[model samples]
Target: MKWFYDALNILGGISFVSVAVIAYFGKLYFERYKRKQDEKIKSLQSRLDLTNAEMKSKLENINHVSKAQFDKEFSIYHEIWSCIFEVADSVSKLRPVLDHFDPNESREERRERRLQAFYDRYNPLVVAIESNRPFYFEQVYKLVCEYRDLCRKEAFEYQHYEDYPNFKDYWESHEENMKLIKEVMQKCSEAIRDRIYSLTIIK
Candidate 1:
């Protein structure tokens, strides 16, 4: 009877030690997991803060652009349109990034994606203008009109012009937006590079 009791006591002690070991390891694992989650949260928050600040600066610059051509709304729109297309072309390689957005399975989805994708690509170009071009407001407005027309295709099914039986005409008309915007952006980019060069003081 005494031997049996001693054996049970040893078993209980062993069980208790095993349980304590598991609980200690579990606490360590939970703490490690919690620390990792905290680090990721802080990193994501930092990125969000940077993105917001950059966007705010861009919005302020856009406000100035609005003021510069208050009398030329159409032209301003066109330049903006050009900027949009230009940025889209630059971001073409990043088209798959839209995968990060909601899946586009409907007309509405496609339109929203098309609209957002273009702006997401181009918003930065709008603020980088270094010099003014001739009749840019009208030119820019025309470009915007082209963009709107393109958007209309994705956003809604339109009656085709009886004279043109295919989508070629519709696509061609708006395709120039990208090309035109590319030219403008290149000029703007050159101007920006020049400005930066001038600002760089040799040590």
Candidate 2:
């Protein structure tokens, strides 16, 4: 009876030891699996962060290029307007001189000096118009051409023979031409201002 009791106690102790060993190995395997999963999650998060950064950089670069292009086009538009304004100023100054004759000089001498001064002021305008032709829109270019033609015609009228007649009629026609030029200048200026406004809104 004593031997049987000892044998039963020994069997119970061995079973308990076997269960503890199995539990310990199972816990180690589960911990390893959990660590592997954590590593995978961290790698995925790193890749996601990299992708986000790359997309942000690309968007910034695109915006920079778009802004530069807008600035360049706007500058050209402004330059065209500047040329128009300069020509308009010169024409305004010459208007009185062209319409009224100088009493100090002979008629032939006055005509020659007036024509020379007109050409000096007007030729640079023509050159500027031609040089900037490719940069400007069709509407702007056409209006500038019309203005130039009006100025040229007025100058030609001023270059009259010494005994030219019909002073009142000539004055009326010139005045009308001047009014038309003013209207055209206003329209061109408005067009440029509107374009600038549109660009500012976009920005």
Candidate 3:
């Protein structure tokens, strides 16, 4: 009976050892599987972060371009109007002094010099507008072109060398045209300023 009891104790000890070995290996396999899953999760998160950053950068670039384009267009419009105003003022001054030309060659020479100066200043502004014609807002550009062309025609007719025989006939109508120009320029300036304000305040 003692020999049988000893054999039972030995079998119980062997069973316990087998169970411990199986549990240890199972824990190790589970830990390795969890580590692989964590690594995959980290890789996916990193890729998502990179993609989000790229998208943000692209949006900012687009916004910058839109703002810059608006600024450029506004600057051109301002320059065109400024040139028109300056020339109009000069012409107004000259118109009053037209009948007072000196009897000697000196007055004619001075008038020629003044007209030449006007041409020199006016030509460059016209060229700049023409050069940037493609970027202009069509309606605004048409108005600008009309204004410029009228200015050119007036200058050609009034220039000392080309002196129109019917200067008095056109002078009265010229004043009315000047008034029209002033009104148009005012409206255009106001419209552009309003648009800029609206855009800037949006965000």
Per-residue lDDT of 1-203 in model 2, one digit per residue for the tens?
A: 88866876787865776797899999999999999999999999999999999998765544222566567657766766666676666555444634566578786786677677667767877786778677555666777778778777777666653234776776677688778878887887776665554443234
lDDT string, candidate 3, 1-203, tens digits: 88866775787765776787899999999999999999999999999999999998765544223656777877877787787677666555444534555566686676676677667667766876788788656566666666666666556655643344575666765666566657666765665564444443123
lDDT of each: 0.50, 0.70, 0.66
Residue pairs with backbone atoms closer than 3 Å in model 1 (clashes): 75-137, 75-138, 78-140, 78-141, 79-140
How well does candidate 1 match the true structure in TM-score terms?
0.31
Clashes of each: 5, 0, 0
Model 1: residues with Cα > 4 Å off, grouped in runs? 1-12, 64-69, 72-203
TM-score of 2: 0.54
Could you arrange the candidates by lDDT from highest to lowest? 2, 3, 1
Residue 31 error, candidate 1, Å: 0.9
Candidate 3 minimal-lDDT segment of 10 residues: 194-203
lDDT (tens digit, per residue) of candidate 1 on 63-139: 23333344454444345546655654544422222345445376456545565665565444434232343434333
